[model samples]
Target: MKLARLAGPTPVRDKILAIFPGALGDFICFLPTLDKLTRDGEIDLFTRTEYGDLLPASVRMRSLECYEISRLFVSGVEEEEKLKRFFAPYSRVYSWMGSGQPDFVRNLTLLSNGKLKVFPFRPSVSRIHITDYFLSCLGAGSSDEITPHIPIRADALAWSGRLWQQSDLERKSVLVFSPGSGAREKNWPPDFYATVAEWWEKKSAGKNLAVLGPVEEERDKISGRGDRVLALRGLELGRVAAVISRCDLYLGNDSGVTHLAAAIGAKTVALFGPTDSVQWAPRGKRVTVITRNVECSPCLSPVMKSCLHHKCLTALSPDYVIGRLEELLG
Candidate 1:
C-alpha cells in the first residue's frame, strides 16, 4: 500500500486515551474511530506494542502488556494513587477492554474522574459489521462507511522490493496465500490452498508466495512446498503488510492477515467457514469473500469448537474459489 500523506500532526490540546486489547482485525475495525477521535484531541492508544507501526504518527502508543496496565484488571482501590497518576493526563478515555468487568470499569471511571467510557469488544448481535458497530458505539451513524487503511512505511516497502528481487520474481505477477487463521475451524484445508495456487499460477503465469505466521509454523501444515511457492516467515507486522501491498491478489481465511491485506488495499479473496462473514468479513474496495452456504454454518463459537466436520469450509472447493478469483480480477 502507498503511504497516505497527512497534514502535520494534530496540535496537542486535551489528551485522550483509547484502550484496545483486541486482536489485529478488531484493532483495524477501531481505526476509523481512532481517526475520528484524533480530530478532537491528541490520542494515546494503549495496545500491543507491535501494532505501533500501524498507527498514525500523531498518535502515541502505550504497551497494554505491561504490568502497570494489567493492574487495572485486578479488583482493588489498593493502587489508587498509582493508577490516578497514570490516568491523570488523559481528559477522556474510550476503552473496548474490560467492559464486562465491573471492577475494571469502576476503577477506570473513578480514576479518570468519570471520563472513561467503556464499550463491548464486540457487538451482542451479528446484525451489523464490526466496523459499523464500533462507529455506532462512538455515536456515529451506522450508515457511514468507514474503511480502515494502513500507510506502508518506506523502509518496509524497500525491504519487500528487495525480497521480490532476491526471489527472482521482480517482474512476475504475484499471488500471496495465507492458509491459517486464529481458529482452526476457520481455516480451509492446506491442500485446497495448494490447488488454488496451482490454478492461479497456470492461468496467470504468476508467482505464488505463502505467508506463514507462528500459528501456521507450529502446525507445520502449509510449508515444505518451496518448489511451488516462496514462503515468508518471521516477519514483523509492518513488513508483512509491505509484502502484501505488492501482491496482485491475496488469498486467506478469516484471519488478521486477511484483514491487513484488505486494509492495505490488496486485492483479497477471503475464505469464510465457521464465522459470520457479514459481521467479520474484510472491508475494502477490491475484496471478495467466498463461503459455502451450509445450513450449519455461521454457528456460535462454542458450536464451532465442538464441530468435528467442518462442512462449511470443506464444501467450498478450490475450483469455486478460483472462479470467484477470476471474477474478482476481471
Candidate 2:
C-alpha cells in the first residue's frame, strides 16, 4: 500500500490572464477562447472597463488600467521590476493588444524573464472567421462554428422591459434595427433602412425599434417616421444586447452591434458592402449576410475606397432585402 502511494509533485491550477484592449467585436470574437479557458481554471480579462458589466460570468473582468500598464512595460517606460509584479500573479498570460505588435510581446516575455508564461495573439488567416483565429492564438484550436457569447445583465433586461412598456411595444413582435457602422459606406442607404423598417412593420405587424449609436446620431439619416417604428438612442451596449435578446429579429449593417445581436441569439440580417463578410460577418445559425457581389466589391478592408458611389450597398434594393426578411421571418 505504501509503495502504491508513491506521489508525484502536486499539480498547480492554472491562473490565466488575457489582455485584449480591443473593440466590442474583437472582444466578442475572443469570448469563446475565454469560455474554454474558464473551463480549465480561473481566468481574468483585461479589456475596456466600459464593457466590464457585460463580461462572462466565468471570467473576472480586470481594469483597463492593467492593459495600459502592460503597454508601458512593453514600451520600456516602466522598469522590469514593476512589470514583474504584474506578471507574477498569473501562471499564464495571453496578450492580444492589437495585431502587428510582436516587439511588444517580446518585451513582455523579456520583462517576465521566463518565469511567467506569456503569449501574443494575432490573426494569420484572412479567410477564416476571426473567432477561429482568436482561439488559435490561445492554443485553444479552431472551432468549426464561430459563435459569440454576450452576457446580458438583469438591470439591462429591466431597462429594456421598461423601454418597451414606455413605447407601447410590449405586446408586439419587436424587431430591432441598427443603421450604424464605423464607416459610412458599410451602411445601407438610410432610405433603404427606412423602407425596410416600413415593410417589416407591415409584414410582421410588429413594432420596429431603431437603435442608433453615437456615430449614427451625427448623420441623422436613419429614422422611422411613424409611431409604429420607435427610434431609440444613447443606449449602453449591454442594454442594447438585452433589447436584442428580447426582439424577434435584428437588422443591421456590418457593425459591432450586429455582432452583439447575433451573440445574444437574435435572428439577424447583416448587410455588407465593401467589407469582407467571410472574415467579419456576424456568426450564428440564424444570421443571414446580404451583399451584392461585384467584381470590385469586398475591398477586404474598412478603409473606404475612392469609388465615390458605393454601388455595392446602394445597388442592394429594398425589395431584395425584403425578400430575405420574408425568409427569415417565415
Candidate 3:
C-alpha cells in the first residue's frame, strides 16, 4: 500500500508487534493509529496492563495480549532481550513509541543485532504531535490525514446501556465531569471543577460527573450531590471509555482521561495548569484548552521539573470554565 512507502524493502507484514507501555489516555490516543492498521496484519500489542482493554475493537481482535513492560520506557541490551523474546517468531515489529519503548521496536528489525538496523526516523525530528509520531512509525503519511475509527465494543455498549437503566438518570443531554488528572501539581482546583460541574448540571439537566480514574477519595469530597456522580475508579479501562463516550461533553485536567474524551469524540474541555498546554493539549479532536498563559505558566512541562506554587491552575476559575463550556455547548 502507499502507506507502506517508508518500509524500504522489508517484507509487507512480518508478524507485526506494536508497543505502547504508558498511561491509559496515552494508549487510547494511539488507538486511532491502530485503527488505520485495521485487518492489515496480525498485530501484537505490548502496553501497560491497565490499558489492555482501552484499545479499539478492530485492533484488539487482531491478536496478542498486552503485558506490563515497565513504568518508564528504558532501553538497552536487557530491554532488547525482552524484545528478542517477544519477536522471536515475528520478523517485522514496530513499537509505536514517541516516549514509550522505541528501542525494543528498533532492535527487533535489526540485521546484525543492531549493527544493520534501520528505523522510520531521522535527525531534527523531536517533540512532534503524538499521533504523527506513531503513524510515521507505521508508514502512514501525516497524523492529520484523518484516519478511520473503530466502533466501541458490543459488550461495552451493553454494559453502558445497563448502567443507564440502573441509574435514575434521564439520559438527557449528559455532561460528564472527569474531575481528576495530572496529579495535584497540574490539576486545577477541585472547587473550580465543582463550580463548572454545578453549572453544567444546572444547564444540561442529566449532567453528572464520571469521576474517571482512581478518584474514589476525591469523589467523596464532592458534597451537596448524592447521585450526580459515578465513581468509575473500579470500572475497567474499556468501561471508562464507553461511559465517557455516552456523554455530550467532558471537562477535566490536562491529563490522560482528558485525552481519552477527545479520542472518543466527546467535546472535551481540558484545564491546563503547570504543563505546557501547547504540546500536551488534546490532539486534532474537538477540545478547548483553558489556560491563563501567565508569565510563569507551563513551567511544569517547559522549563522546571515541577512548580513550587501552582498559581497557574488556581487562576482557572469556575466562571472561566463555565464561560468556555457555554460557548462549547452552544
Candidate 4:
C-alpha cells in the first residue's frame, strides 16, 4: 500500500528585511512600494507593532524595540557576532532609519555583510509627491496611480459594526472628522471643524463623528453637539481605520488618520494650511484637497510655528469647505 505524503510549509522565495520608523502618513505613502517589493519576495518589517494590522499578510512585522537593533546606531560594534547572526537570515536589508547617520549606515552595512541599503526618511529638497519619491528611491518608475490601499480585516470590520451599533449610527450616512494633526500650526482650528459639522448634519441629515488621537483628546473639539455628533477617543490605529471605512465621507487635516482614511477608500476632503498639498496630499481618486493659495502659505515648520496670524487656514471659511464638500459629494 502507498503511504500518503504530508505537505510541508511553503518556503519564502526571497527573504527581505526593512527597517522603517515612519509615522502613519509616511507608511501610507510607502505602501505602494511595499506592495511592489512583496511581488519580488517575502518582506520582514521592523516597525511599530501598531502598524502590523495595516500591512499585507505576506509581510512579517518585527518590533523595533529590540535592544540589539538600537545598537546599530552606535559607532563601534560591541556585539558584532550577535548582530551579524541576527541579520544573516535575510538576503537584503533596507532601512529608512539612520540614513543621515554615517555610523549607523557603516555598522549595518558591515554587519549585514554589505546587504543593507539605506534611504532617507523623507525627501530633503525635492517637492515630488512622497509616493513617487519612495518609488524613485527603489529605482522604479512612477506609479500610474498613487493610491495606497490597506485591507480591513474581517475582525476589524466586525468591531466597527459593533461600534456603529453602540453609537446609534447603524444605517446612517456618517461623516468622520479628524480635526488635529501632529503640528498645531497644521490644524485648521477646532471651531472651524465644528462649523463644518453643524453644516454637514443640517444639510445631509448625517451623523458626524470626530476621531481624536492623543493630541486632540484634551481639547474637546466636538463635544456638546447632542446625538448628531459623537467623539471617538483613544482608539488604536486599526480600530480607527475600521471606523473610517464604515463612513460615507471623511474630512481631516494633514494627519496620519487622514492618510489612513484615504487609504481605506473613504471619500475624503483633506484641509491644507501650512503644508504644501501638492507634495503631501493624500492620493486617491475620491479625495479632494482644499488649500488657501495665500502668498505666505505653504510655509515650513519654522515659519508655521512663528506665524502669529494663521490666515492660510483661518481664511478657509466654513462656507468654502461646505461648498467643496457639496461639489465632492455631488
Pairs that clash in candidate 1: none
Give the better candidate number (1 or 2) by lDDT: 1
Which sections of candidate 2 miss by over 4 Å? 1-12, 65-80, 98-103, 115-122, 216-219, 224-228
Task: State every prediction's TM-score relative to the real structure.
Answer: 0.93, 0.87, 0.75, 0.93
What are the clash counts of all predictions, listed in order?
0, 0, 0, 0
Residues 60-106 of candidate 4: C-alpha lDDT, one tens digit per residue: 98898987678988889935788878888888888889988988898
lDDT of 3 by residue, 1-330 (tens): 366546568556535556554465555556666666545666666566566566553343332233323422344544445545644665444544433246544444351233222234222354565656556666677645453233466788789878767765455777777677746566666666666666766775755756555555456565335556555556775776788788787878877878877767777788887776645578645778888887886563444445666777777778877787787767
Q: Is candidate 1 or candidate 2 better by TM-score?
A: 1
What's the distance in Å from true for residue 31, model 1?
Answer: 0.7
Write down the lDDT of every candidate, Cα atoms only: 0.86, 0.75, 0.61, 0.85
Higher TM-score: candidate 1 or 3? 1
True-vs-predicted CA distance for residue 138, candidate 1, Å = 1.0
Model 4 gets an lDDT of 0.85
Tens-digit per-residue lDDT, 146-259, candidate 2: 587776799999988888788787778888898887776688888887787788778768888888877754236555375656777877788888889888889899888898
RMSD of 1: 5.7
Please give the lDDT score for candidate 2.
0.75
Model 3 worst lDDT run, 10 consecutive residues? 115-124
Best by the lDDT measure: 1
